[model samples]
Target: MEIVNFTPVPALIGGALIGLSAAFLLWSQGRIAGISGIVGGLTKPVRGDLAWRAVFLIGLVLGGVLYRVLGFGVGVDHIQPVVSPTLLVLAGLLVGVGATIGAGCTSGHGICGLARRSPRSLVATLSFMGSGLVTVFVVRQLMGVGA
Candidate 1:
């Protein structure tokens, strides 16, 4: 296995921000700020829920814009995976559907759910992580992909 030159600082900073945002959302809004729920609200929204979801999403975009303007330049040149665009899109769709069916995504289940000390969330997170590890092993080791 090749060593990865990952910089921990950026990851730590990102994790802190994510933790803060989740905590704030739970404290202020009395809601979990799951991205899927926020986006789903855009489609079939309740009366009071729509406005905040819209605001949250808009704030997300505005936050990105502000970061860029303030010279926190975005990382554009991400490493590419060895998969076709079509396959990636399909996989994303499947994951989205699975998350919806499973009641939450990794951010919601792994971060916020575990924060609340929910057993179901812990199981879901472990399953998700295990599946991801197995998938990566199969793809990189067995299939010789994305090397």
Candidate 2:
């Protein structure tokens, strides 16, 4: 697919913010900013670990809301789901499985792991990118879906 309404500045700012937040989380909490791990930990509900995870998840939702409320054009205003809800749920589940098998999500492996120069993260990131590319090719080209 083709990229529509690509805005480099906004993308750059978003990336920088993500990086900063990840770094700060690591520095302060001594934890990886992996969304999957954070969420998964909640399932087990370790006594002392609950608060931070809940707050982090809340902050994630609030961040988007704040972005939209502040008139940031790059938030959710342009999001248009191209696939069915069933397909989206299937995709999310598959990603969750992949993250489980890979030992970490993209934020943990891609941003934090890469920054620490972990070879496993390198391979994991490559696999994630390759799988994404193949999926896009299959969905957009072979299946003739999405623009």
TM-score of each: 0.85, 0.90
58-141 in candidate 1: lDDT tens per residue?
998987787678776656335465698987998889888878777788888999999889999899899889998998899888
Error of 1 at 46 (Å): 2.3
| Candidate 2 stretches greater than 4 Å from native | 1-4, 73-75
Give the Cα lDDT of each candidate: 0.83, 0.90
- Residue-level lDDT of model 2, residues 1-147, one tens digit each, is 579888999889989999999999999999999888898889768889899999999999999888878987675667888998999999989988898889888898898899999999999999999999999989998998875
Model 2 weakest 10-residue run by lDDT:
71-80
lDDT of 1 at 50: 86
Q: C-alpha displacement of 49 in model 1, angstroms?
A: 1.7
Where is the poorest 10-residue window by lDDT in model 1?
A: 73-82
